[model samples]
Target: MKKSSKDSVVTAAILLFNSKGYSGTSIRDIADAAKVNTATIAYYFGNKEGLLEYCFTYFFEQYINKMEASFATIEKGAAICLKRVVADLLHYQWENIQLASFVYREMSIDSQMVREIMATYSLKEKYYLQKIFERGFEWNEFRPHSIPYLIIQLKGLLMMPFMNTHYMREVLYVFPNEKFFEQKYLKDLYQWIDKTLCSDIQIKKEAIIK
Candidate 1:
């Protein structure tokens, strides 16, 4: 299938935004990379901020869709559902590393876009995660834990690699975009979920207490 001009522009914008901070990237750079003129970019996105909004919207829409799909398809306990959700998220970030990197970087700053995401997609994401945790608690698949704290940890684990790509590459000597890193990081993530979130001992303790 042929890619649309809008998609091209978006792709170029993500690349530029990932390489250069959002403040540093310009419409002209995206236009030149996308092989489209500035006028076309303006026609499609209206302005650079508009293009950024589209970028964020597109990323989160797809992101939430993937999360929803993962949650819906799982019929198992909360532990399994949580694992699937994180696994899907992990792979999605690897597959869309540029956009993932850019999105998380932008999320660190305070802005209208960030506020909008927090209200909409971010809240939705948290709701799904909270539901999974709540289900696990009800079914005794996971121990009782603070949902907000767990979510903060989960977000940190998921975002750290992509958010610190330069450090991963230069300081840690790990290339986040590589398949090797994905596999290793995913293994560690699963361990964290199992040990921290779904500890059998913890669950058994809660069960005994009840």
Candidate 2:
């Protein structure tokens, strides 16, 4: 199917935003690349910031939708469910690696956009993650751990590799955009789940008592 004009604009914007930070990229640049007029961009997105917010919203909407779907379908333990959630998330991020990288980088700044995201999608993400961990603990599938910290850990794991793509490629010599990297990265996440969340702390405590 032929892409929509709006999609073309967003595509161009993401590319420009990724290479040149949001502050550096101009509306004219996006318009030139997208082959659309500035008036069209304003009509669709209002302004550059609106475009940025749309990009962020687009990413999180799909992200939360994926998580919700994964949660609804999975009936097994937390480990399995979380694996599916993270897998889905990773797949989506990798599919839009540039957007993912750009959005995450943009998040570092304190702005109204960041604040709004924290108040909205970030809370929803936390809620879903909290539910998964709660289920894990109730079912004795996860070791005792603070949910907030777990959320932080999971977020870091998900964001770090992609957000620091240049570091991964240049410094670490690991190519995050590669199929092999995805497999290796997923393997590492599974190991983290196994060792951290799935470990039987109760058993260890009882053994220590004995």
Query: What TM-score, over all chains together, does every model reach?
Result: 0.91, 0.92
How many residue pairs clash (N, CA or C atoms closer than 3 angstroms) in each of the candidate models, in the order given?
Answer: 0, 0
- Cα misplacement distance, residue 163 of candidate 1 (Å): 0.8
Query: Largest lDDT belongs to which candidate?
Result: 2
Q: On residues 89-121, what C-alpha lDDT tens digit does candidate 1 reach at each position?
A: 989999999998898889889998899999999
User: Which residue pairs of candidate 2 clash?
Assistant: none
lDDT (tens digit, per residue) of candidate 2 on 119-179: 9999999998999999889878788899999999999999998898989989999988998
What root-mean-square deviation over C-alphas does model 1 reach? 3.7
What TM-score does candidate 1 get on C-alpha atoms?
0.91
Give the top-scoring candidate (TM-score). Answer: 2
Candidate 2 achieves a global lDDT of: 0.89
Q: Which stretches of candidate 2 lie over 4 Å from their true place?
A: 201-210
